[model samples]
Target: MKNYWSRWMFVPALIFLFSSCGPSAHIEKDKSVDFSRYKTFAWVDKDGEGRKDRNNRNDITESNIRTAVNKQLQKAGFEETKRRPDILLSYDLLVERSTVQNNDPVYSQPFTRAFYSPYYRRYFFVNYPSQFIGYDRSERSIKEGTVTISMIDARSGKTVWQGWATDEVSSRNLTSKEIDAVVRSIFKKADLAKR
Candidate 1:
């Protein structure tokens, strides 16, 4: 009986200690968002440029991007405003694009990869994660991008909901599949009560 109790206590104690060793994060919503107040949807381009130029409405021709976001909201049970949407819709596009060299050594050969192995191979024996770190020898580059999002109240003309996503833009510009995946993930993260 004593041994059983000790074993049980040992397991839970290790679990508590291991769990507590990590970070502490919590966010409780007093209540969910009420979509009732919003009705109309109109795209906004506060700083209209290539990101979202009202003058060149044709420049931002990815209606599917908007559609994908709308679908996510609808799936979450928010009704879209048909006529005069309660919410004034606007696309606030803030695209941060950069060429990021993926130092991920997966592309490098076994010995050639950026093996950030301790320079003192004899005494300092430590396995570092430099295999993928571009280090000095091998390098890979890709376009990394971030899109900041925003929402405005149609009536009051005030900003309401806002969110953004950072993603990899391939050589093919912004593929529909890429946009859809990233946008959907953004909505899910900004909303889901993670299970």
Candidate 2:
């Protein structure tokens, strides 16, 4: 009983912690474009020249991002073709320094006190009121990463679908897990239908 109660008590805190760590994803696409027609995709640059313009480019990070994106696209029933794909895929990643403000609530820890229960003829544990002291305000600099993926119409040379994801990163380069998360988040918002 005690373990069950304690487990349930931390549910809200666990939820908040996880919810705050997820990346923010957004997508934009041509409303008139038919996503179902895009059956094959080829990278705009098979080499790494596409990312040469980015100052924070890391070869390993780029590879991880591409692999993750490839997995998601293939899962969506899109094939990778080099000859001439229906859509051209391109991706860009940027990690910039940013400041985050923290305003955490301060509260006194609750204590349990024994109280006499005349009706029950026994003693029971009563929780004392925990007062909110105030909020601790602080600021810290952190690295934020934004990954954008664009799918363009090969013949028209116009972007048909684009999605981006932003999240707090530990450093200038993203870990494998983080790259996967970013790609998964962006693809989750993509309007790809399985063929």
Candidate 3:
């Protein structure tokens, strides 16, 4: 009974351990652009005219994202400006839901026991077991969220760099610190300094 309980406990621990490792970021950039030439950036919607159309995000959420991005960019030596900036910065948030079905094989067998005959001194099997077969299915719904940041050349008006991070969404909303961590992971893969 103890061994069965231990095995049952171990399965969930393994799933939790793997799931908590977090998600990876994906980044892409235009190789032809000269990143060193750009030192300043301005928000794509500097005038706030396109905010309603492009980003339907709430004010608080948008503010948090912008603050996080600003900190990360400033750390990378890029300054924010209102006029004649070298590059334009913009971001988008997305949430998607999907169903995941897991078909696990459930096995069952009849209990067996060996009994010894005193006269013959031989053991005989009772209640022989049967072949194993799958009998159960499980299904779950999962939500995934993603944040994408883009950098465009002010003069050419073309996207020069893009980075995105995706992770499984939880029931509770993400904290500011968690959002910052996700942005940091995306930029780590971007490696803008190398450009």
Best by lDDT: 2
Sequence-dependent TM-score of model 1: 0.51
Question: Clash number for every model?
Answer: 17, 0, 0
Model 1 misplaced regions, further than 4 Å: 1-36, 44-61, 93-97, 101-139, 192-195
**Candidate 3 lDDT for residue 129:** 68
Tens-digit lDDT track for model 1 on 1-195?
Answer: 998898788888898886444212222322444545554465543464354543233344357567777777667655565566666555433344455444433434343224344665544334434345344444555665444445666676766666666666664345667667667666665663221
List pairs with backbone clashes in candidate 2.
none
Q: Assess every candidate by TM-score.
A: 0.51, 0.74, 0.69
Candidate 2 positional error at 114, Å: 17
- Root-mean-square deviation (CA) per prediction: 12.5, 6.9, 7.0
Error of 2 at 23 (Å): 0.8
Query: Candidate 3: misplaced stretches above 4 Å?
Result: 1-20, 46-55, 103-112, 115-137, 171-178
